[model samples]
Target: MSFNHPTTVLVIGGGAAGIMAAITAAREGAAATILEKNERIGRKILATGNGRCNLTNTDLHLKHYHGQNPKFAYTALTEFNYQNTIDFFANLGIMPKTETGGKVFPFSGQASSVLDVLRFEMEQRKIIVICQADINKIKKTDNNFYATCKDGRKFQANRLILAAGGKASPNLGSNGSGFSLAQSLGHHIIEPFPALVRLQLAESFLKQVQGFKFEGTAEIIVDNKAKARATGEILFTANGISGPPILQLSRKAGEYLQKQLKVWLKLSLINHLSTEQLEQILLKRWHNQPSQSLAFSFTGFIHKRIIPAMLKAAGIEDINKKVSNLSSKEIKQIASILQDWRFQVTGTDSWSAAQVTAGGVAVNEVNPQTLESKKVKGLYLAGEILDIDGDCGGYNLQWAWSSGYIAGKNAAFV
Candidate 1:
């Protein structure tokens, strides 16, 4: 049972990748249609960058991404990389501003503007966008794909591009629908997990200082070996840790969690000094400020809010205790606490808070150059669905543009 219609291309998913694919296919002389399960296209776009989409990064690098095959993204990424993304948005009349660390934000600081530009491009090109259409299954016959919706509607096309995102951010309509479709078609899926998310800490003191934020370095240890580390401003949550540094390290921590392995998160509140160096410095400080209380002496070296805790950790019960009266071992303990304040990460925040998913449709089943499926003809993979994900600061969005562009261009041909 099928309501077959003549179309050159059918693109599923209406996020950044699907919309881009629709625009490119239409521009390349194909009758393109986009099927979005949600009521609106680009639902996730609104949540990006806290309402202002960090569209892309001025700094693009391979090191920002993760996958079983790290090299799998090279071709498509190179084909429609960062500059291409900037040009595409610029052509739409959106002037992006570069913020700290090369993050690019729209000058208007509105994600809706980015969505409008994309929607306008589609409208100008006469691309059909169908909303609230949940594609139940994709059945391929010879040279055509028949996409049957859950509501009993069916769409037929000579070519199909699956730009459906990963399992993360389900409220945005990315709840692993793409995975179900890909699996039905015999595509290998690299087990999906949350990435670019905040980690849930085992310690409860994080709640007492939930809103507190500070610049620190976080190191990840997997089975006692240093796995990864990041340095940035981190925010304490009621049950966990969130922020740039913690988010970046959370990816590896999630992977380790999936493997049933234990991971340790070490936090360095004072990153510039080693324990021994700090100890020596503190000893010298005692000589320099003999009459100063231990807590008072730490005022210049550490944040005032955390000074009491540091002192307590150093076995200093009396806040007004003179630095000169502190024992040698107590001084060393204080120095150690200053250098390394460790935290244990038991898990991560749910997928809703995650910026991107770690795994998706296996890259091995898709052509790295064209983003076309090696297993299914006329089937293409893009965005977070292709086992390609990047770090925060706009790299993931860059992947969306690059993969979407390639899939759209190729799906339009033949």
Candidate 2:
């Protein structure tokens, strides 16, 4: 337990959380070492926010997160909120800015820069970094933890911080191995699944609206109850729905489906507009182009690519029909469909397509304030390895920062 031993702290997984934990532990006068399984650190971070590196979010409330015990994040989040995250990055020489919906990113607008700051700080703090350390086994003996990598190298330290991320985007190095490592040490894992992922839908609309992108609101209804909603850019993939709003809804949709509950996606293409307003607008468009085909009438109002498909979904299949022939009933149907398009959420995209993992090491087994294991002394958990997952707009990264900060601080001094 000597702080001056120069090898007192060891952090597994050189991800967002591991990097932060190593930096803090080393700076707090403990010898810190980070063992990353990948060839490079922060690979997943480079792909976040479409390469802009959303480092944190302004919204730090518990509701923005999901877990068996979402409230478990309160202590760590309060100890190191978004303000502390901003200040920490500022101290590391990263000027940050927030975009719409409070997603915070470095002023450089490059995820590489975020990694750069973290790497630079780690180097300045003299934190030992070992990349390509694909650890497979961790054991606790006496008062020390020993880690054995698949490559036969061994790591030993007085304290161990498991910041290894969950199984999401395996190419980025989260291959679910961390769960095995934690489970080996008496940690209960709550079946890990994909989060912040796109949902696959029936080909009926997907094939027709593929590649069509728009701004809209998406709601997740579980067992006929609205669970969550988000308003942002929505994109129709060749096989499913995507974009921020859809991604925000996908987590809950997948969770409910896992529990055998009925889940559906309710989308409002004409967000913020009432049914009356939408109907009036549709009527005006038809009146202005009385002789135009149904397709032609909606051309200027909606994307031409989606007009036919939308009309078809609304049960108005004749695209060649003249707008002037539309009765009040047809007009109302179009408006209603526009405002309340429903789709069955078959399932979420694979883990490779997910931005985060929803379930991991259960929360109740860890200390809320320090993130230390209640089952084993000198062991801690942080980041996606814990059960907590957050919204797509940088809330996940914020959780990493908060939990890593708490775990690192306590690991070094405790």
Best model per lDDT: 2
Local accuracy by lDDT, each model: 0.86, 0.89
TM-score quality measure for candidate 1: 0.92
Each model's TM-score? 0.92, 0.95
RMSD of 1: 3.2
Count of clashes, each model: 0, 0
lDDT of 1 at 82: 75
Residue clash pairs of candidate 1: none
**lDDT score of residue 165 within candidate 2:** 96
Per-residue CA lDDT of model 1 for 183-263, tens digit only, reads: 999998899999989899786456567777788888898778889999989888889888889988888999999998888
lDDT of 2 by residue, 28-118 (tens): 8888999999899889889988999999988888889998899999999999999999999999899989898888999999999889989
The most accurate candidate by TM-score is: 2
